[model samples]
Target: MDLQESFINSPDHHRIPLLSWAPQTPTAVLVIAHGMAEHAARYQPLAQWLNQHQVAVIAVQHRGHGPHCPDADLGHYADKRGWQKVVDDLQQVVVHARKQYPDLPLTLFGHSMGSFIAQAFTQKYGDQIDNLILCATNRVDKPKLRASLVLVRSIKALRGKRHRSRLIDNMTFGTFNKAFVPNRTSHDWLSRDPQQVDRYLKDPLCGFSCTAGLWSDFIGGMLDINPRVWRKDLPVHLLAGSCDPVGEMGRGFSRHVTNLRAAGVKVASERLFEGARHELVNETNADEVWHHILNCLRPETHSVTE
Candidate 1:
């Protein structure tokens, strides 16, 4: 396997960082869109695993969340059109990956916030890839999304987009830990592995509060999700942990699946792990999760219903 890292130019004079891991002869290309408050490097282990399976991996470090970012710009996607700009960054990475491996089918895998971006990407640019994978993603209802966006906008107006609100932070990242009382750490909901949780906490880029503008922009992206925009031929896999608060503990996945099928998606497959949490990729049963994902990437003759 070979590993490489590079930067690509995007709009607004911003440079997006990307990490690539691949085998000598890859059968497919997997492009990963990482979650908020984290960098693409965190997924290196997973990428290496996929590389062993003869799949090339390219992970696009989202704007404001990588090691290359300046400290002040760590949580800001952009000063304007932040959501669209982030999506555009993903597109740039996809174009780069296409150049590197033009003949292979590319699959987009997104986790948490990345899943939201992937949703917008597949809708506007579904033809760029052959398959979609969404993990630990929640159902987006317009009423709630609109309300949150409005609230974030109001806060931004009062304190500016660069401001971070403890209230919003508590409402989100803070609330997620409530289910696991007497938590060892604030991020216990991430996975069942204690060491992995520690590693996440130790990573400087893993935990940071997003600005109000970023939140508003992210919600706006979710609101912009129009089922009709998704390509019917694209095979989509929805993955979530039954204990994940972000997924509303499986309820959100159920509703979201219903929404996807209602949109006339023919090959939308979903899997909910029995006792997993938010970050299934980092969980104790991650190997099993990886195998399941590999199966999904397999040919029609293989079973993806593990």
Candidate 2:
């Protein structure tokens, strides 16, 4: 596998870091959008696996993630227009990927919060992508999300856009840890693998709280994307861990698929991994998850090799 790192200028003038893995002759290109509180480097395992299958992988560290994006602080995309900027950053990466692999089909693979961006991206740029892969995704209840947004907005108004609110963080993520009572870490819901959970807890950039404005923007964006009419012709593959609290233990994921179907999306596939958690890619059975992802992207491909 060949690895390369480069920076692309986003619409907001922020330099976004892109990590790429390529094979000598690529069959397709996958543009990966990582989740919140995490960076693209974590996807190296998946990228390498794709490379083995003659698939090229490009991952972007969204603004406020990793060490890139000097303009934005950790856990904060922007003071205003944060979610839009994240979406714009993804589009910029897609444009770059197309220029690099003009002939090969391109698939957009998004995880968690990134899935929300992918959903919104398809609404505007569905023609540009050949397939969409959403992992650990869910549909937001408008009423509940709006109420949370109000609280986040009020916090932003009082504490400023950059202020990190523990109250908000607890309200948002605290219940997730409850599912794994007597757990070793607060991020136990992230994965069943203890090592994976430990790595996240040790990483300073992994579990930090986001600014109130960031949360407000994220909820707003979720509401905007969740209700939009998706393109019926687009092929969408949704993956989730049945143990993932974010997906409401698969119920929310099913609801999301149902909603998309209701909106006339004709080509959609949903896969629920039993006992897997939020971070399927980092779960104990991650190789199985990867195999499912590969099959989704390239149905003709051979079985995953050990």
Candidate 3:
């Protein structure tokens, strides 16, 4: 099915594009937020599957990540401007969806950096969604790390160039592609089958590098969404890849499952696939991943096990 994208005009008429797949039976509406440097179109497969099962999907391309990004440079998000702008844009989309699908069950799905936005969105718009799903959600690190990033950026600024050094930023996290998959060809982290990774690597928009400031902003944003700061008691589901480098906090997430339950929130479920990488929804075993996700969206199908 083809997706229809609409330009959302917010104040400056920033064209925020949206993709929708209308379902025949119309069980629910899944609103998706893509990770850093990626557009919303990548989630088309998931949206198509959901549509077949009588569910619609609406995906929003964040302010600076789309083809029409305001800042064509790397360091735009190093500051809070880009991140906050995306959050507001996402909220606007949520409001728009509620108006369009008032009676259907609304589910918010986020991956990686998008998960941070989804969690933050839940805090502000908790009553609007029935279920919140976060995949490959990054956890906060020590305050010293945050300070170090600031110091590094300050030193770079002193050199007379704006933004942090791209080399340093690349060394830090760009190595993630290597860490998670070892050889990008050995196995596709997104799917259980080898072809899935092949498709991802071939996809022009799948992965791209971010600025040091953008990296710092992302980590800081996750800190802001830590379950500690999570105030929404809505049904929440956390999914991470066991072998995924981004899933560094799998054990930590398990350790704190009780805390989430005590907060009047249902853990609904938390799953860590044996060797799945960052993007579970698009994994080779996506059918399995999609099953669990749909289960979370439907209260009748909720299961504690993966």
Q: Identify the candidate with maximal TM-score.
A: 1
- Which candidate number maximizes lDDT? 1
lDDT tens digits, residues 1-306, model 3?
568778777655566788888876786888999887677888888898878777889999875566555554433452445566667778888888888889988889989878878877876667778888988874545574577667655744664333456565455446455664465563344455567667766765545556555655555565565464454557789888776666563664454355566655667788887777777887767888888888888858556344
Q: Is candidate 1 or candidate 3 better by lDDT?
A: 1
The estimated TM-scores of all candidates read 0.97, 0.96, 0.84
In model 1, which runs have C-alpha deviations exceeding 4 angstroms? Answer: 301-306
Query: What TM-score does candidate 2 reach?
Result: 0.96
Relative to the true structure, candidate 3 reaches a TM of 0.84
* Ranking, lDDT, top scorer first: 1, 2, 3
**Model 1 error, position 98 (Å):** 1.0
